[model samples]
Target: MNLALAAAALAGTPNDSHGESISQGVDSKHILVSQAQDWVAEDRQLQKSTIEVAPSDRRLIIPVCNTAFEFNYPFASSQKTLRAVCPSSGWQIFLGISVHQSDNALRYTGNFKAGHQLTGTDVELASLSSAIAGLAGDLRAIEGFSLASAVRAGDLVMQRQLVTPIEGYRLNRAVAAGEIVESSSIDSILIASATLSAGQTVTLEQLDGARAARDLAAGKVLSSYDIKKRHQVLITQSGIPRGHPVTRANIALQDYYGKLPNDSLQNYRSAEQMQAIRNLAAGTMLRLSDLTPIDIIRKGDNVQLSVRAGALEITVTMLALENARLEQRVLLLNPESGEEIQAIATAVGQARGLSTVAR
Candidate 1:
């Protein structure tokens, strides 16, 4: 994945009382391949020869990740204008909902270097106020929000009131080291296709340091003229059938000050029920997730699931798919039958009229 296309690799543990449970997950994370019959289209920067299976040929469809959505985050016209921008668009969100110690800290890094340097500390309040308000508004809506930056310190901090009346969310995590930990522009988002080299390695590009700054130095934070980033990732495996992971990765980028960009950012997901009807009617391509599995009744008879929205709209549909893995022994009856047929499964969806769904 090019930096422009995808990003995120989770890490960090929320320092709190429940920290024990927060630090580790029941299972360590590892990349797995899936979809043996299908071909693999190596996504981003991952090379695969494996497949990842959703425990039950299904996984709980939790709302996660966002991409094009960030592209829509309405650009804020410098902070001075004081326009009450609510961060309604453009800015994308990487919901590090994982309370796991290794997944709590949100990381943000892009191309921007210390925002357009100002002539004086007094600059304009309107723009800064707008930025603060915009920043604060976003904090209020998202839970446990933290502001990371390369320049915030002392007086440059974002107070709770600036974010929301809600008491819980705030920039509480202090930087233990450098400048990159706090600033939005200092964080880095990467995308690529790579083979397995290390087993879940945590690469700390910058040492830890002071958290977000509320103050500033004379020089601007450095940045390349053209930089790209992202928070959502799609890992596709290589080899036989290959597999794809619809997941959110955990990652963070800290600058010289240990500061990361803004963490008050948010990501969104449309519920299954909501997308199904449209897909069924206009032939919309509903998320594969929305399809719930029904019981298998008979041979040739399809397994059924519902495409629904809320409790009101539900469309029952057929889902027939074949899945088989090579068992130890071969088929006995067919004497002449060759080695064992590892996997076999038929897939039948309500594809009859689903073609029109593609955008």
Candidate 2:
């Protein structure tokens, strides 16, 4: 007789009528089913109510084992099939099972059109079975993604239906041609259009020292080709005559987007104590070679010559023999003694004697 049927008959037969005890033999089928249920609950971390075990056939019979039965999953590489083995008896049986887990997934709260960017209000978490939830991608990251196609209310948000937004910078206000592209004047934005790619966008660091190449409208997305590095070059605001001082009043620093000459002057301090070497028109870019150090002493000028010895000093008026700047050596002629002296030009009309010689 089948073990299942015999177990059922024994369960139905009264002990007094059969004059036999209920524990005469073990029910192998019941043991296998109980063991499979316990395995699913413990190993799979599934609730007993969520696990379903198929009923054993009443005609199927499994021999009772003298030792403990070992259990394993033998088919589909999953916990669906539970194989219970009677090691001592060399018999085993396969049982089928199903596990259902409840999970949360993101779904559209209302109908949305294509190209619509998902916001917090557009999606909500909804309870769903594992089989249905698996179809949806990560629920937490669906927000801020643009929809590739229209979606209806209560539809689950899926990875395939999303178009990642292209991140870039946009001008907060209109920028005129040749104006500096300041980081504070632009705002970061996301473009939801399918036609744009990430490579077409520009980053904030790329905008450093950048200027607009042309007139740009407000809220327009900026690209790498739309901006150029701003180069600073000194420009004359008014015509500077030759021998005139190159001061801040006449020359101003201007921003240039195009390439500048290698000799262009970049700082105002560099032009200190310098004079224009040639006539420069208004708005002309200043170059290093265009200016010369201002001469503190001019030829044929009378300069005070000072001679110093141990605890003694002598001052005399002499004629400068050559044009010289401060700290430059110049020859001076002594009118009374007809003597020549080499001295360093100290001021506009002053010189310090270095050595004396007879003419």
Error of 2 at 311 (Å): 5.0
- What is the alpha-carbon lDDT of model 2 when measured against the actual structure? 0.75
Candidate 2, residue 52: CA error in Å? Answer: 33
Q: Candidate 1: what lDDT?
A: 0.23
Candidate 1 residue-wise lDDT, 61-148, digit = tens: 1122221112111235421111111133322222111111111111122221222111223111122312332222222233432222
Best by TM-score: 2
Tell me the TM-score of model 1.
0.15
Q: What tens digits encode model 2's per-residue C-alpha lDDT throughout 253-298? A: 9977665688899999888878899999999999989989888888
Q: Candidate 2: where is the Cα deviation over 4 Å?
A: 1-185, 189-211, 215-225, 228-233, 247-249, 252-259, 311-313
